[model samples]
Target: MFWSKKNGNKSQEFQEILKLRSELSFKGIQFDKALFQLLTPLFEENPLLFKDWKDLQNKVLQAVEEKTWTIQDEIEFIESYVNLWKIAKSDELHTQLTIKGNQQDIQIFPLITFGAIQNALQLGYNSMREHPLKIRIQLSQSTLQLEVSNRVNHYLQNQADNMQFEYWKNRLEYRYPEKHQLFVNSNSNIFKSTLILQIA
Candidate 1:
């Protein structure tokens, strides 16, 4: 009985280690994808312009290792992709940002939040026509809300997009089982997603 109990504890510990490693790996991949999306266009257009890509990459990796990010970090991260969108889509893309409450040094899960931002950007780009792509972020004492919306053709609203959003929603739920809420809605001409995280 003693040996069985010991082995059971060991097995449980091993499983936990594996789960931690898997989550870390997923976080790394998500960050890399977001970085790639932000840098690929600049690299293609003028490689020399992003001579610091490797350095920026290292900074991002370090941030992931630390597992916490400040409000400035989050804003900078989102703006990177927004800048890329401006370069790639030009006149077709329009973005607005509104920040409220105190955000000076608030800490957040950069990997999870940024992953959702990347997903939203891709969805908007894929479905957007002449209408502007809109992103709104609100920071308050108790909640962080991110909303992304874009006008799309009625036919573009399909199951694949919902599945993609679901994937991110699931990740958020896993990361913050009791602290986050996600909502996605699509109508004949518009697709919108909102993610709200309760600050601890």
Candidate 2:
């Protein structure tokens, strides 16, 4: 069959993708990096049928079955992804950046990205309600800049008491190698961290 036909076996492919998506969704699985990496081979053979969320879910499940990826495995993957995105989105940068000197030509540190995200989440919180922090993301050509500035009671100096923050920072370094930059500062009663990421 000609690859350009876009008809032959298309129905079967869609069925397989749909079936995979349904199974994973029922299993409450989130297709994340670890799962993807573990299942790349299965997907490599079949190729991706669709890029839609539903399609991706199916691809993920297909990989899981072939690679024996467990739900716990997917959970860990999601935990990391959520942590990264959550912090990057919520924390805000100190608006009036005081550049003391020239733009220091420093190698970007990935841990900084994780740190920046962690800092933002910590800074933006209110006990009055549940889930008070909100994070926003913007990606540009050269950098994936994240702003996580949230309204909270604590200041920059006092927010480091929690162990989770430290743990996350370490995890960031483990994941990013040397491809990230993190800047954290506060102004006008808001705690924020900016993560500038150089995509590899």
Candidate 3:
């Protein structure tokens, strides 16, 4: 009985070590992937522009070694990743942005919240001139809200774009614990997604 219990504990410990290693490996792969995805356009357009390619390579290695990101850290990480991609694409493409409405002091996972909304703005809207997408951030007494609204085509009957939004919603639950709420709605010619984070 003593040997069985000791072995069980050892097995549990070994499993935990494997789990941690697996998570680290997955994050390392994702970091590399996100960087490649961001930098590929730059390399394709002007290889010389990536003059500091070695610096980027070092950063990825460091990030992996540190196991650097928490659930909350992923927001800023993705935001920075996407922002670089946008800047790289700007040489040939013009991406316009309009920021309106009020900004608030959101205490919980600010980077993630900002990144989700930023990425959503790019992906959620079909066109800037015709069906413009609007994202607004506001704060109440104890709650912070991110509202994303976009005009859609009348012929499209389903909320096909919501699957992407749903991924962020799940991330919030995992990252924010019990402090976040997400509301999503679609109507004729419009789709709206709202994320509410309660101040802790």
Candidate 4:
């Protein structure tokens, strides 16, 4: 009877041990996962991301020789580009893309949002599943808008960033000078940028 009782107690302790491991809790404080845990997800994701990366690169290369894009073309490029980031991050980063208007037969500057998105991902506040990085595109009869927002990462705040706003500024000035507006600011630990161009 004593032997059986001791065996049952050992089984209970083993179960508790497993519970503790799965919960990853100690003294009621949860532990952050080890960095190594990211490797599995990264490896699993790169194969698909490689294909996406190639496609994006090709698009960019083609654009260098022929710089022409319609609103719908840019829309498709952003969708694919953002999807690359989504897959590469493997849910380590959260992303949302919302488009609320139909395509129009209007020309738009291609790759306008790429730099902004790169900045958002690189300067992510947490780059964790709980945080959100959003890219929004809103098209109306008169205006086309692209906006990106993310929590500011304090750690990278001190580092120099080359967003090349000048390049975009020149492009916008040349294309839509008086017809476009550019807004960028990092206030209260939130970084946001929006470009609105008059298409009509």
lDDT top scorer: 1
Per-residue lDDT of candidate 4, residues 1-200 (tens digit): 35688899997886565444322211111111221243346645466555556566566545531255787777787777656556656657778778888787766556544546655655566365555888898888889888888887776652115423344444455556599898887766678888888888
TM-score per candidate, chains pooled: 0.71, 0.37, 0.49, 0.66
Runs off by more than 4 Å, candidate 2: 1-123, 126-134, 155-157
Evaluated at residue 152, the lDDT of candidate 1 is 52
**Comparison by lDDT, 3 against 4, better one:** 4
Worst 10 residues of 2 by lDDT: 95-104
Considering every candidate listed, which one attains the maximal TM-score? 1
Candidate with better TM-score, 1 vs 4: 1
Give the poorly placed runs of model 1, Cα more than 4 Å off. Answer: 1-45, 52-56, 90-92, 125-130, 153-155, 159-164
Clash total of candidate 3: 1
In Å, residue 53's CA in model 1 sits off its true spot by 4.4
Better of 2 and 4 by TM-score: 4
lDDT of 1 by residue, 104-191 (tens): 7678766556544555455555433456666678888778888777665454545235544455555565566689887777777666
Q: Comparing candidate 2 with candidate 3, which one achieves the higher lDDT?
A: 3
Model 2 local distance difference test score: 0.43
Superposed Cα deviation of residue 65, candidate 4 (Å): 7.3
